[model samples]
Structure formats: structure tokens, C-alpha cells
Target: MKHLFLTLATITTLLLLLSTPPTTTAANAADNIVYDVIGEPLQAGQAYYMVPYDYSDVGGGGLTWLQKTKVTCAPYYVSQENVNTNFGQKIAFYPQTPGQTDITLSSILNIVFSSFTPPINCPGTSNVWSVAADPATRLNFIELRGSRGTRDLRTWFTIEDVDQGGYKISYCPRNRRVDCGSLGIVSRDFGRWLGVNGTNPLTFVFESEEFFLNKALGTKSYAA
Candidate 1:
């Protein structure tokens, strides 16, 4: 009778354990926290200035500031300059999943330059960044979405925290697992442009617009 009672108790405990939902732990909480340069958690739709994680590595003594190429229709691509003009380009993220307030690491999202206004003659209507072949260079480069189809998997990207310490952008369409690469700078005749380089991607940090404004006013650090 004792052996039977012990067996029954063990089975009951196992059943209860299997039925309980998994609880959120500290590690799960950490997964949700992606901090900007100001040290605050990054949120969807918030504007930020992305600067090279190692500012000194950029050419011409300028930190790599992401800006758009001033080209004619169908080739308005994203390029980086080695200089800081004012506060630099403002970027924002839109998570693919609806209603998600905070942008988390490894989440599929659409990156957009908050200040870009497509030219009247531009081919695509979208300002959302997408990886497409540059008509001019015939090389795969980041360009505005739309002409390539609204649902193109190439429009999707993911943000991940690099093991070496900063955030890196990667393009790995869910539909095509084989199509994957990390974004880095490539030197062109015009200037350094953003491209899907190999494994060694350029990592960057986000600075809040408000932080720049406050610093300009001689105010204390925004993180303070």
C-alpha cells in the first residue's frame, strides 16, 4: 500500500508540473531591455540618432553618420558620412508585431529615417528601409521600400546585441533562411555606403534627440 501511495503522489506531482504555464524570469526580462545611448530602454517609434560604436574608426575624422544619397529616381540609397552635421540623422523602428511598445533585441522590425522625404520623381513611395539592388551600383544596398512590393521579405530586418558589446543590424528574411548578412560600410566612389557585408558588421549605439538638445543647452546629462 505504501509503494502504491508513493507512486500515485509522484505521478500527481509530475502532472501538476506539466500543466503549469512557464513563468517569466530575470533572463526573460533582460531580453526585453534594449538600451539607447541615453541608457533608457528603446521603444518603438522613438526617434534616435545612430552613431558608430567606435566613432574614431570612421574616415575623415567624422563618426559614421547615416544619411541618404542624393540621387535621381530608383537609386536613392543610404550612405554614411564621416562627419557630424548638427545632431545627425534621426532613425526609428517599427516592430513587425503589432501593439508591441518596446523594441527588443532580435525582433523583426522596419527601420526608417524619420527625416527622409522621397523626391517627386522617386520610384518607391515608402520611406521604410529595405535591402535592394542599387540601380546605379548594381550592388545590394539599403533603399526605401515600395517598388519591390510591400510584402517583400527583403524589407524585414532584425536588431541584435553583438557579443562584442553593441547592437548590429542583420537582414535575414524569415522566408529565405539562406539569405542572411550583417550590415556594414563599403567604400564607393561617392563615399562610404551602407551594405550587407559579411560576418563583421558595424555596430552602433542610439542617442536620443532630446539628449542632444539638452546637451546643447548646457544642461546635465540626460541619463541623469
Candidate 2:
């Protein structure tokens, strides 16, 4: 009887352990996670990409800064699209544009992602995707470098679209100089946008993070 009871207890314990979900540590949780908004209110039609800015080496000029990038959208969905990545793991984004008279920024601007071909030798590269807007702004701010020990990149962005009578003004903040070879970044205001009325300037901001995973290409992983 004693042996049977011990055996049952051991089996139950093993089953429980197997059924239990994996718990992510606080530090690991910070990696590969998405942050909605920080520092300012996110406008409806504006979107921001939180590109990671890693500054570890002065001689190399912080090669990790190259991983930073930006993608803008009018509505929130469009921003989500910018975050979407598939097997190849390329980064893509949309541009900002003026909203129609009847449509507000909240309705016109949104994040959407489609298939793309990334640059050569860049894992998860993307192709020439469409912007879906005219007179819009698009730019690359930084580049990523070799992997660190579970240390993912982090960055933030904001988008704003304010009504200025006959037209609308949109602005996205970008870094001016990005050293891909050395993976260094120079902090300069590369603010860009379209439909500026010269009077009322609308602004919005959003933040996001990018993690460099070691998983094999085309493998799927989820953060629950």
C-alpha cells in the first residue's frame, strides 16, 4: 500500500509539472515584447515604430544602433502592420498622408502588412512594398548588429496629424545618419511628413521593440 501511494504521488507531480505553463522571467519578459505608448498621446491616424538603439561600443560607434527603424501609419492597425514579420524576418512600414475632408486621422491612418522581399543577405528581407499614399514619408534610421545574450533591441515613435484648414500636416521623427558598417547612429532630427499647411501641425507618437531571435528561419514562435 505504501509503495502504491508513493508511485501515485510521483506520477501526479510529474503530470502537474508537464502541464504547467512556462513562466517568463522579468528580464526575459522585457525582451521581444510590444509597448503601446509612452511619453505622449498616440493620435488616431499616426503610427510610430520603436526601433532599438544599442550603444555598447564607442570605437564601433555602437554597431547595434543599425537595428533601429521606423514605419508610420494613419490608424492603429497600420502600425500593427509595421510590426508584422514572417519567415524571412524583414522590416517594413507605411508612410503618412493627409486625411480626406470627411475622414479624420482616426479613420484614415492604420497599420497593415503585406509580403515583401528584404535586402540581400539580410535574414527575413522584404520586397518593394506599396505605400498606398502619395507625398508620404519613408526612411531608415538605424541598423542591427550581431546577437547579444537574450538582449533584444528597443525604441519608440510618435505620429501626429493635425487639421490645418484646407490641408493636413503629418510628421514622423527619424534619425539623420545611420552607419550600417559600424552599426553607429547619429542623433539628428530627420522629421518628415506630407501635406504641411504651414499653420497647424499635427503630431502623434508610438513605441515598439524588436528582438533578435536565434530560432531557425521560417520557424514560428509566440510570446504568450
Candidate 3:
């Protein structure tokens, strides 16, 4: 697959937002958070290609959420579509349960992603901070499962944030196979790959549930 690769000159759009995230208020329980891999917004209702920090198609070739499952993969994006609850299914991801999908800290972040979309230049507008949590336990988690026989393998991540410089934060690991935690933070001084050129800071934002629901539904954009 082809993850949209933005050259230094093309990322002006994201850079502008990144530089301004500092003005945004700290995330509260009831806010829609923005998260992304490589500084792109995970657009709602849009199926997108996803990859781990370890993998790269820097030259413009890589796997996506639509490909064979791996330790980390996703065509993950936000949507009003009811999140898949059937654990038996191939894939699922959501920030909160339907009934209590409140944009509050108490709800707990829950995101379940299953599926793959190959590499392409990743868009700067489709990155989103999906706060996946259990409907019952309300425990924070980021479930990363493989396909079929390997699907049972998973990891849980607790969401945390930073506001000083861009949207700095990590999914701090709760469970998984190898080198878990730090929930994949790679920035100023953390994460799996350090100081790679063209990589984005693992940062994000939280917004009101109502705010994002509308954005997902096409009733709004990030301007609100």
C-alpha cells in the first residue's frame, strides 16, 4: 500500500496546527481528543491506512490496515457507525461505549483496531486520538490485535498527554507482547525510533464528544 508521504515542504498544514496546539486547553474527561501517527488527523467515517513506528515506507512503499495483520496495523479512523462489540469479529475500535461515549476523563479511553490498509502517503488531516475503553471496566486501553489465529494477541494502553510543545503524550503500555508501554511515544526524547527525519511527534488533542460526532458526520470540520 502507499502511505501518503509528505515532504518537508508539504507538511505546512500539519506544522501550523502542531505549533498552535499549545494554546489549546488541557484535555478534560469530556473533550474530543485529537491523535495521530505522523501528525495526521484520523478522520471520522474515513477508512485509512495505519502502521507502527517501527515500519516505514519512507521511500513510498509500505503495508496498510488492509494488508496481513502484524503486531500493529489498522485502517483505523473515526465514525458514527456503531463500534464492533463482537470480539469474535476480525476487528474493532472505539473510544467509549455507545451509551457512555462521553468526552470525559472518567469514561476511560478505549480503542480497538482490526484490519489493514497498505502504505500510501498518510494524510495530515486524518490523524485522530481514539480513546478506546471497555464498556464495563472503563479501563483505558489500545487493543492491537492481529488477524485470525494471531488475532488473540493484543496490548492495552492508557492515554496520557502533554501540552507544552505540540500535542505531546504517549499511550503508556498496560499489556502486550514485546517492548510495550510508552504506548509508542517517539519524540524529543522517547519512543521506539529516535530522531528519524520526517517522522511526526506522537502528540494529540481532546475535544468535546459532540464536537467530533459532528465532524465524523460531515456536519463540521476542525474549525470548531
The per-prediction tally of clashing pairs is 1, 38, 49
Models 1 onward score TM values of 0.75, 0.23, 0.29
> For candidate 1, lDDT tens digit of each residue in 103-191?
88888888887877776765565667878765685566776654222466777788888776678888887666344788887776666
lDDT of each: 0.70, 0.27, 0.32
Name model 1 segments beyond 4 Å from true.
1-26, 60-71, 84-87, 134-138, 146-150, 177-179, 198-200, 221-224
Q: What is the lDDT of candidate 1?
A: 0.70
Question: Could you give candidate 2's per-residue lDDT for residues 1-224 as a string of tens digits?
Answer: 99999999999999999988766664454332223333233333232332222112211110111121343311111111111231212232332344322222322222222232234555522222112222232323222211212212112221223232111213232432321111112332331111222211223222322222322333434221
lDDT of 3 by residue, 141-163 (tens): 33222222221223222344444
Q: Is candidate 1 or candidate 2 better by lDDT?
A: 1
Question: What global local distance difference test value does model 3 have?
Answer: 0.32
Question: Considering summed lDDT, which 10 consecutive residues are worst modelled in model 3?
Answer: 80-89
After TM-score superposition, the amount by which residue 35's alpha carbon in candidate 1 deviates from its true location, in angstroms, is 0.8
Off by over 4 Å in 3: 1-99, 105-108, 113-153, 165-169, 173-201, 205-224
RMSD of 1: 4.6
Error of 1 at 77 (Å): 0.8
